[model samples]
Target: MVRRIETDRLILRTVTVDDAEDIFKWASDPDVNKFMIYPLHKDIEVTKEWLRSRDIDGNDEFDLGFVLKETGELIGQGGIFYKEDLDAWAIGYNLRKEYWGQGLVPEAMKAIIDYVDKEKGIHAIVGEFAKDNSKSRRVMEKLGMTYWKDCQYSKFDGSATFDAYLYKREF
Candidate 1:
Protein backbone atom coordinates (compact mmCIF):
# COMPACT_ATOMS: atom_id res chain seq x y z
CA MET A 1 0.00 0.00 0.00
CA VAL A 2 1.10 3.54 -0.65
CA ARG A 3 1.89 5.40 2.55
CA ARG A 4 1.16 8.94 3.54
CA ILE A 5 3.98 11.32 4.42
CA GLU A 6 3.50 14.42 6.45
CA THR A 7 5.73 17.43 6.49
CA ASP A 8 5.25 20.63 8.47
CA ARG A 9 3.01 22.17 5.85
CA LEU A 10 2.09 19.48 3.39
CA ILE A 11 0.94 15.90 3.10
CA LEU A 12 2.39 13.60 0.46
CA ARG A 13 0.02 10.81 -0.47
CA THR A 14 -0.85 8.52 -3.32
CA VAL A 15 -3.06 9.96 -6.01
CA THR A 16 -6.59 8.57 -6.20
CA VAL A 17 -9.50 8.71 -8.62
CA ASP A 18 -11.11 11.23 -6.27
CA ASP A 19 -8.21 13.58 -6.89
CA ALA A 20 -9.04 14.02 -10.56
CA GLU A 21 -10.65 17.40 -10.09
CA ASP A 22 -7.77 18.72 -8.08
CA ILE A 23 -5.28 17.31 -10.55
CA PHE A 24 -7.06 18.90 -13.42
CA LYS A 25 -7.19 22.25 -11.67
CA TRP A 26 -3.43 22.59 -11.24
CA ALA A 27 -2.29 20.40 -14.13
CA SER A 28 -4.37 22.19 -16.71
CA ASP A 29 -2.61 25.45 -16.01
CA PRO A 30 -0.16 26.24 -18.77
CA ASP A 31 2.19 27.93 -16.33
CA VAL A 32 2.48 24.78 -14.21
CA ASN A 33 3.18 22.63 -17.26
CA LYS A 34 5.81 25.00 -18.66
CA PHE A 35 8.81 23.10 -17.31
CA MET A 36 7.12 19.77 -16.81
CA ILE A 37 7.87 16.76 -18.98
CA TYR A 38 4.19 16.52 -19.94
CA PRO A 39 1.81 19.08 -21.23
CA LEU A 40 -1.09 20.50 -19.23
CA HIS A 41 -3.84 17.94 -18.91
CA LYS A 42 -6.56 18.60 -21.48
CA ASP A 43 -9.58 17.69 -19.39
CA ILE A 44 -10.93 15.93 -16.33
CA GLU A 45 -11.33 12.64 -18.19
CA VAL A 46 -7.70 12.75 -19.19
CA THR A 47 -6.65 13.34 -15.61
CA LYS A 48 -8.92 10.50 -14.44
CA GLU A 49 -7.41 8.13 -16.98
CA TRP A 50 -3.92 9.01 -15.92
CA LEU A 51 -4.79 8.49 -12.28
CA ARG A 52 -6.39 5.14 -13.08
CA SER A 53 -3.17 3.75 -14.50
CA ARG A 54 -0.96 4.88 -11.61
CA ASP A 55 -0.60 1.62 -9.75
CA ILE A 56 1.56 2.55 -6.80
CA ASP A 57 1.53 -1.00 -5.43
CA GLY A 58 3.09 -2.54 -8.53
CA ASN A 59 5.46 0.18 -9.72
CA ASP A 60 8.84 0.69 -8.17
CA GLU A 61 8.43 4.34 -8.93
CA PHE A 62 5.14 6.19 -8.90
CA ASP A 63 3.74 9.68 -8.63
CA LEU A 64 2.05 11.25 -5.59
CA GLY A 65 0.09 14.40 -5.16
CA PHE A 66 0.99 17.05 -2.59
CA VAL A 67 -1.69 18.60 -0.46
CA LEU A 68 -1.81 21.34 2.13
CA LYS A 69 -2.44 19.95 5.56
CA GLU A 70 -4.36 22.87 6.96
CA THR A 71 -6.53 23.65 3.98
CA GLY A 72 -6.78 20.23 2.37
CA GLU A 73 -5.79 21.78 -0.91
CA LEU A 74 -3.91 19.95 -3.61
CA ILE A 75 -0.76 21.87 -4.34
CA GLY A 76 1.12 19.70 -6.83
CA GLN A 77 2.68 16.32 -7.56
CA GLY A 78 6.11 14.69 -7.19
CA GLY A 79 7.81 11.27 -7.24
CA ILE A 80 10.97 9.24 -7.26
CA PHE A 81 11.80 7.62 -10.57
CA TYR A 82 14.05 4.76 -9.51
CA LYS A 83 17.23 4.27 -11.49
CA GLU A 84 18.37 0.68 -11.15
CA ASP A 85 21.65 1.17 -12.97
CA LEU A 86 22.80 3.82 -10.54
CA ASP A 87 21.09 2.30 -7.54
CA ALA A 88 19.56 5.68 -6.96
CA TRP A 89 16.36 7.58 -7.57
CA ALA A 90 15.63 10.62 -9.71
CA ILE A 91 13.21 13.03 -8.05
CA GLY A 92 10.75 15.30 -9.82
CA TYR A 93 8.16 17.77 -8.57
CA ASN A 94 5.86 20.49 -9.83
CA LEU A 95 3.97 23.10 -7.79
CA ARG A 96 1.08 25.27 -8.71
CA LYS A 97 1.93 28.89 -9.50
CA GLU A 98 0.05 30.06 -6.43
CA TYR A 99 2.35 28.10 -4.16
CA TRP A 100 5.67 28.79 -5.91
CA GLY A 101 7.39 31.03 -3.35
CA GLN A 102 6.14 29.36 -0.19
CA GLY A 103 9.03 26.91 0.18
CA LEU A 104 6.66 23.95 0.11
CA VAL A 105 8.49 21.95 -2.54
CA PRO A 106 11.59 21.55 -0.43
CA GLU A 107 9.44 20.70 2.54
CA ALA A 108 7.78 17.95 0.55
CA MET A 109 11.09 16.83 -0.92
CA LYS A 110 12.67 16.47 2.50
CA ALA A 111 9.91 14.10 3.60
CA ILE A 112 10.32 12.01 0.47
CA ILE A 113 14.11 11.85 0.66
CA ASP A 114 13.93 10.87 4.30
CA TYR A 115 11.30 8.20 3.67
CA VAL A 116 13.16 6.62 0.75
CA ASP A 117 16.44 6.70 2.61
CA LYS A 118 15.09 4.66 5.48
CA GLU A 119 12.53 2.46 3.74
CA LYS A 120 14.09 1.80 0.34
CA GLY A 121 17.70 1.85 1.56
CA ILE A 122 18.41 4.47 -1.00
CA HIS A 123 22.03 5.54 -1.33
CA ALA A 124 21.37 8.73 -3.19
CA ILE A 125 18.70 10.87 -4.78
CA VAL A 126 19.22 12.87 -7.95
CA GLY A 127 17.31 15.44 -9.91
CA GLU A 128 17.61 17.55 -13.06
CA PHE A 129 16.30 20.96 -13.86
CA ALA A 130 16.18 22.89 -17.06
CA LYS A 131 19.15 25.23 -17.00
CA ASP A 132 16.88 28.24 -17.09
CA ASN A 133 14.64 27.19 -14.22
CA SER A 134 16.46 29.07 -11.51
CA LYS A 135 13.76 28.47 -8.94
CA SER A 136 13.97 24.71 -9.25
CA ARG A 137 17.76 24.77 -9.28
CA ARG A 138 17.66 26.75 -6.07
CA VAL A 139 15.41 24.12 -4.52
CA MET A 140 18.02 21.46 -5.32
CA GLU A 141 20.67 23.57 -3.69
CA LYS A 142 18.42 24.13 -0.69
CA LEU A 143 18.04 20.36 -0.38
CA GLY A 144 21.84 20.01 -0.35
CA MET A 145 22.02 18.43 -3.79
CA THR A 146 25.35 19.15 -5.38
CA TYR A 147 25.85 19.94 -9.00
CA TRP A 148 27.10 16.72 -10.53
CA LYS A 149 26.98 17.25 -14.28
CA ASP A 150 25.33 18.84 -17.26
CA CYS A 151 23.79 17.34 -20.37
CA GLN A 152 21.24 17.80 -23.08
CA TYR A 153 18.01 15.89 -22.60
CA SER A 154 15.00 15.40 -24.77
CA LYS A 155 12.03 17.60 -24.01
CA PHE A 156 8.61 16.26 -23.10
CA ASP A 157 7.19 17.38 -26.40
CA GLY A 158 9.88 15.37 -28.19
CA SER A 159 10.48 18.27 -30.49
CA ALA A 160 13.93 19.34 -29.38
CA THR A 161 16.63 19.08 -26.78
CA PHE A 162 17.33 21.31 -23.82
CA ASP A 163 20.23 21.82 -21.45
CA ALA A 164 19.79 20.48 -17.91
CA TYR A 165 21.82 20.55 -14.74
CA LEU A 166 22.09 17.30 -12.85
CA TYR A 167 22.13 17.41 -9.07
CA LYS A 168 22.55 14.68 -6.49
CA ARG A 169 22.83 14.05 -2.77
CA GLU A 170 24.10 10.94 -1.06
CA PHE A 171 22.13 9.59 1.87
Candidate 2:
Protein backbone atom coordinates (compact mmCIF):
# COMPACT_ATOMS: atom_id res chain seq x y z
CA MET A 1 0.00 0.00 0.00
CA VAL A 2 1.12 3.58 -0.58
CA ARG A 3 1.44 5.12 2.83
CA ARG A 4 -0.23 8.36 3.76
CA ILE A 5 2.32 11.01 4.63
CA GLU A 6 2.18 14.16 6.73
CA THR A 7 4.55 17.07 6.94
CA ASP A 8 4.62 20.34 8.80
CA ARG A 9 1.99 21.96 6.59
CA LEU A 10 0.62 19.30 4.31
CA ILE A 11 -0.82 15.80 4.05
CA LEU A 12 0.11 13.62 1.10
CA ARG A 13 -2.37 10.88 0.28
CA THR A 14 -3.80 9.06 -2.67
CA VAL A 15 -5.97 11.28 -4.84
CA THR A 16 -9.23 9.96 -6.25
CA VAL A 17 -11.83 10.94 -8.78
CA ASP A 18 -13.71 12.64 -5.95
CA ASP A 19 -10.96 15.22 -5.81
CA ALA A 20 -11.23 16.15 -9.48
CA GLU A 21 -12.72 19.62 -9.05
CA ASP A 22 -10.14 20.62 -6.49
CA ILE A 23 -7.35 19.23 -8.66
CA PHE A 24 -8.66 21.06 -11.70
CA LYS A 25 -7.90 24.32 -9.95
CA TRP A 26 -4.23 23.88 -10.79
CA ALA A 27 -4.32 21.23 -13.52
CA SER A 28 -6.11 23.66 -15.76
CA ASP A 29 -3.70 26.50 -15.15
CA PRO A 30 -1.25 27.13 -17.97
CA ASP A 31 1.33 28.76 -15.74
CA VAL A 32 1.25 25.74 -13.45
CA ASN A 33 1.61 23.33 -16.37
CA LYS A 34 4.29 25.17 -18.34
CA PHE A 35 6.59 22.14 -18.10
CA MET A 36 4.20 19.31 -17.49
CA ILE A 37 4.21 16.13 -19.55
CA TYR A 38 0.46 16.45 -20.10
CA PRO A 39 -1.56 19.15 -21.80
CA LEU A 40 -3.62 21.72 -19.95
CA HIS A 41 -6.89 20.12 -18.90
CA LYS A 42 -9.65 21.78 -20.87
CA ASP A 43 -12.48 20.78 -18.56
CA ILE A 44 -13.40 18.94 -15.39
CA GLU A 45 -14.14 15.82 -17.40
CA VAL A 46 -10.59 15.85 -18.70
CA THR A 47 -9.21 16.03 -15.17
CA LYS A 48 -11.57 13.30 -14.07
CA GLU A 49 -10.51 11.10 -16.94
CA TRP A 50 -6.87 11.76 -16.19
CA LEU A 51 -7.35 10.89 -12.55
CA ARG A 52 -9.16 7.72 -13.45
CA SER A 53 -6.31 6.69 -15.74
CA ARG A 54 -3.80 6.84 -12.90
CA ASP A 55 -2.42 3.77 -11.15
CA ILE A 56 -3.92 4.78 -7.84
CA ASP A 57 -4.36 1.26 -6.52
CA GLY A 58 -0.94 0.02 -7.53
CA ASN A 59 1.61 -0.57 -4.84
CA ASP A 60 4.59 0.40 -6.97
CA GLU A 61 3.32 3.81 -7.99
CA PHE A 62 1.60 6.47 -5.95
CA ASP A 63 -0.61 9.18 -7.41
CA LEU A 64 -0.85 11.51 -4.46
CA GLY A 65 -2.62 14.74 -3.76
CA PHE A 66 -1.09 17.23 -1.37
CA VAL A 67 -3.59 18.86 0.96
CA LEU A 68 -3.00 21.72 3.33
CA LYS A 69 -3.41 20.32 6.85
CA GLU A 70 -4.81 23.57 8.21
CA THR A 71 -7.42 24.21 5.55
CA GLY A 72 -7.97 20.72 4.11
CA GLU A 73 -7.42 22.27 0.74
CA LEU A 74 -5.88 20.18 -2.00
CA ILE A 75 -3.15 22.42 -3.36
CA GLY A 76 -1.53 20.04 -5.88
CA GLN A 77 -0.52 16.51 -6.65
CA GLY A 78 2.65 14.45 -7.28
CA GLY A 79 4.02 10.92 -7.15
CA ILE A 80 6.95 8.50 -7.28
CA PHE A 81 6.74 5.74 -9.83
CA TYR A 82 9.04 2.98 -10.92
CA LYS A 83 10.48 3.47 -14.39
CA GLU A 84 11.45 0.28 -16.14
CA ASP A 85 13.64 2.07 -18.65
CA LEU A 86 15.69 3.63 -15.89
CA ASP A 87 15.42 0.79 -13.36
CA ALA A 88 14.66 3.46 -10.76
CA TRP A 89 11.87 5.61 -9.50
CA ALA A 90 11.02 9.09 -10.80
CA ILE A 91 9.47 11.83 -8.69
CA GLY A 92 7.31 14.69 -9.88
CA TYR A 93 5.14 17.32 -8.20
CA ASN A 94 3.27 20.59 -8.73
CA LEU A 95 1.64 23.11 -6.39
CA ARG A 96 -0.88 25.89 -6.82
CA LYS A 97 0.95 28.97 -8.08
CA GLU A 98 -0.23 30.86 -5.03
CA TYR A 99 1.67 28.45 -2.80
CA TRP A 100 4.99 28.67 -4.57
CA GLY A 101 8.22 29.47 -2.61
CA GLN A 102 6.81 28.25 0.67
CA GLY A 103 9.11 25.20 1.00
CA LEU A 104 6.06 22.94 1.12
CA VAL A 105 7.02 20.77 -1.84
CA PRO A 106 10.42 19.97 -0.40
CA GLU A 107 8.93 19.17 2.96
CA ALA A 108 6.52 16.75 1.31
CA MET A 109 9.25 15.28 -0.88
CA LYS A 110 11.51 14.70 2.10
CA ALA A 111 8.87 12.61 3.79
CA ILE A 112 8.43 10.60 0.60
CA ILE A 113 12.15 10.00 0.30
CA ASP A 114 12.28 8.87 3.89
CA TYR A 115 9.35 6.52 3.44
CA VAL A 116 10.78 4.89 0.34
CA ASP A 117 14.22 4.57 1.84
CA LYS A 118 13.23 3.10 5.16
CA GLU A 119 10.00 1.35 4.39
CA LYS A 120 10.49 0.41 0.77
CA GLY A 121 14.24 -0.23 0.86
CA ILE A 122 14.72 2.09 -2.06
CA HIS A 123 17.99 3.94 -2.10
CA ALA A 124 17.78 6.23 -5.14
CA ILE A 125 15.32 8.17 -7.17
CA VAL A 126 15.49 10.79 -9.88
CA GLY A 127 13.71 14.01 -10.87
CA GLU A 128 13.90 15.87 -14.13
CA PHE A 129 12.52 19.23 -15.13
CA ALA A 130 12.66 21.81 -17.88
CA LYS A 131 15.96 23.64 -17.92
CA ASP A 132 14.29 27.00 -17.43
CA ASN A 133 12.40 25.80 -14.35
CA SER A 134 14.65 27.34 -11.74
CA LYS A 135 12.14 26.81 -8.98
CA SER A 136 11.97 23.07 -9.60
CA ARG A 137 15.75 22.89 -9.80
CA ARG A 138 15.91 24.56 -6.43
CA VAL A 139 13.50 22.01 -5.04
CA MET A 140 15.77 19.18 -6.26
CA GLU A 141 18.79 20.90 -4.76
CA LYS A 142 16.99 21.37 -1.46
CA LEU A 143 16.30 17.66 -1.39
CA GLY A 144 20.06 16.92 -1.75
CA MET A 145 19.73 15.77 -5.35
CA THR A 146 22.58 16.39 -7.78
CA TYR A 147 22.44 17.15 -11.45
CA TRP A 148 22.85 14.02 -13.56
CA LYS A 149 22.50 15.11 -17.18
CA ASP A 150 20.50 16.96 -19.79
CA CYS A 151 17.97 15.65 -22.26
CA GLN A 152 14.86 16.58 -24.15
CA TYR A 153 11.33 15.82 -22.98
CA SER A 154 8.01 16.76 -24.43
CA LYS A 155 4.38 16.62 -23.57
CA PHE A 156 2.78 13.24 -24.19
CA ASP A 157 0.67 14.81 -26.93
CA GLY A 158 3.80 16.38 -28.48
CA SER A 159 2.34 19.86 -28.23
CA ALA A 160 5.39 21.25 -26.41
CA THR A 161 8.97 20.30 -25.75
CA PHE A 162 11.72 21.21 -23.34
CA ASP A 163 15.46 21.06 -22.86
CA ALA A 164 15.53 19.17 -19.62
CA TYR A 165 17.91 18.58 -16.72
CA LEU A 166 17.86 15.36 -14.69
CA TYR A 167 18.78 15.15 -11.03
CA LYS A 168 19.20 12.19 -8.69
CA ARG A 169 19.78 11.49 -5.02
CA GLU A 170 20.80 8.36 -3.09
CA PHE A 171 19.84 7.58 0.43
Q: lDDT winner among the candidates?
A: 2
Q: Per-candidate RMSD vs. true structure?
A: 1.6, 1.2
Global lDDT scores for all candidate models:
0.83, 0.87
Q: Lowest summed lDDT over 10 consecutive residues: which window, candidate 2?
A: 114-123
Candidate 2: regions farther than 4 A off: none
**Model 2 root mean square deviation, Cα atoms:** 1.2
Point to the candidate with the largest TM-score. Answer: 2
lDDT of 1 by residue, 1-171 (tens): 677999888889988899889888777998777677775688889889878887778446746789999999987988786888767799899888889988998888888877877766777888888898899998999889999999667756685566989899997
Predict model 2's lDDT versus the native. Answer: 0.87
TM-score of each: 0.92, 0.95
Given candidate 2, what's the lDDT at residue 169?
Answer: 82
